[model samples]
Target: MRLRDHVVVVTGASGGIGRATAEAFAREGCAVVLAARREEALEATARECGKHRGARTLVVPTDTTDAEAVEHLARRAVEEFGGIHVWVNNAAVNAFGRFEDVPLEDFRRVLDVNVMGYVHGARAALRVMREQGRGTLIDVSSVVGAVTQPYSHPYGMSKHAVQALGSSLRQQLYVEGVKGIHVCTVMPATIDTPHFQNAANFTGRKVVAMPPVYSPERVARAVVKLVRHPRREVVVGPAGRALVRQSRTAPAVAERVMARQTEKTHLSRKEEAPATHGAVHVPIAGEGSVHGGWGGRRRTGMRRAAVAAALAGAAVAAGRRTGRGAPGC
Candidate 1:
């Protein structure tokens, strides 16, 4: 379905890819409903979307993990912009550490927000879309869903579940012959988001080691493209997409490489200094700096360019290794 005249609801709209995606849809002339826990941030995103000229936007401070809140978000979007045409499940959290070292509560929180949050949005959107007989459901999964690393068990598990959820939902849709309704999963590499810093970590360090980091806008743009044309899955970046291909071609080799990488990667759980209110910094942007500057075309363009460059570099290195009949020399 075209975004120009459709209504879209985006969870985790306060920052990162969600914020970028809301603006993207608005630029496409889609009326957008932005939802997240932070009201002020959501308002800021809404204002940015409003600046885009073609789209009308609404902000709903919503915690997507809350079923009631998600239901309300869906209802409000319909009330304000007619029926919902697309729903993007982008809310997620991370907790890095050995499974035993990570607290049970922390694991639960991540699962609730990352896994169950998708479920909540999917359930709510499916209800309205099925009634309307048309809709698109977009899920932001991760490369971890396909190949996991050490110390990221909770996050990986959540992503894997989300992938399964998307797969199952798509199959169910086909069985029901739900014309015009689509579900898709987007798996990306380590995004340059604050997930590393703000995510609950048992190691107490900042930023785990991931060779290439893509910007949130890279994934955000993919979401926009997917909404325009739904697919079963879209893996963002050449490196990430290639890894999925490699996994299918040589599962054992991919597994060994990932296991070695995970073993060598650093795991930091160091807690940031609490603010005056005793709240830790929420890692929505990224550790150390926000790559794309605030919200803008130039910054977004630069971020995507950087990620594309990294992807190209990785691909060249991988190709060289393959030519040499070695994984890496």
Candidate 2:
């Protein structure tokens, strides 16, 4: 469970949870391999990892949606690090729009990265881990995996599939007598990451917003726990935790309430000019730029973030209680 000296491979390491988790593991003395589609970003994240002395780091630019590329990522990790002990499947994308409005290509893309990305990572890591006799596959799922969301059906579907696959894989490992290898899922609510901003906005509404968002470091801290002691699943943030609890205790009521709340909300309306579907904007809000200030200034950032997180958590809880979503800001 000690990460010191362990070899860890993190997908989607360019930013958000991946970057934070990579740095966190590095600080614990783990040899880290950071992977992402952007070579520059991956390299930069690896450099951050290097700041933690004694922890060697490598940058492998990879497109998780591609099976061949993912295979290369695994081979490179083993070739360089000797072996892989922990593989964090954290790469994903989202498109915000009604099912009818979202393009089929977008749906396929989301599934490929979110669902198949985990499949590929788990397959590659499981092979190495099974041979090593001990390893862990940590998946970064979302709160939507367990609940419903408006204007983000594609993302929600992909995450739900991930949750299902994670559970099935865990059982498969048990059945195969793979004792040391563990498959776990991290289901979090809206964390303050670039994911939401990068989310394709086709909802015909501008100004994307969420009531509350948890800091990426909170998620990083949770991943650290999984590295130390793997669990079947862990929900981040109070809202996320409460929703999971509510889902279990009142599945019908929860679904009905969530359905109603989503119906009342509007998603992103950002549109690209004709012939250009690609966007250069930061994928999500608070991405790239650090919130609050530098170094220890996280204190101020955390204070503000805590309030938002509380509001988000309360909103979800209140929605469940009242079966209605409050008006958007």
TM-score of each: 0.82, 0.82
Prediction-by-prediction clash tally: 8, 6
Q: Once model 2 is optimally superposed onto the true structure by TM-score, how far is the C-alpha of residue 125 displaced, in angstroms?
A: 0.5
**Which regions in candidate 1 have their CA more than 4 angstroms from the true location?**
263-329
Local accuracy of candidate 1 as per-residue lDDT tens digits, 127-226: 9999999888999998889987777787889999999999999989889888789999999876665455456656545545364566777788898888
Pairs with backbone N, CA or C atoms under 3 Å apart (clashes), candidate 2:
194-284, 197-283, 197-284, 198-283, 198-284, 205-269
For model 1, name the residue pairs that clash. Answer: 194-286, 203-269, 204-268, 204-269, 204-270, 205-268, 205-269, 205-270
Q: For candidate 2, lDDT tens digit of each residue in 58-114?
A: 888787877888889999999998999989999887777668887888777877888
Q: Provide C-alpha RMSD values for all models, in order.
A: 7.3, 8.9
Top of the candidates by TM-score: 2
Overall lDDT per candidate, in order of appearance: 0.78, 0.77
Quality of model 1 by C-alpha lDDT = 0.78
Q: After superposition, how far is residue 122 of candidate 1 from its true place, in Å?
A: 0.5
Model 1 error, position 234 (Å): 0.4
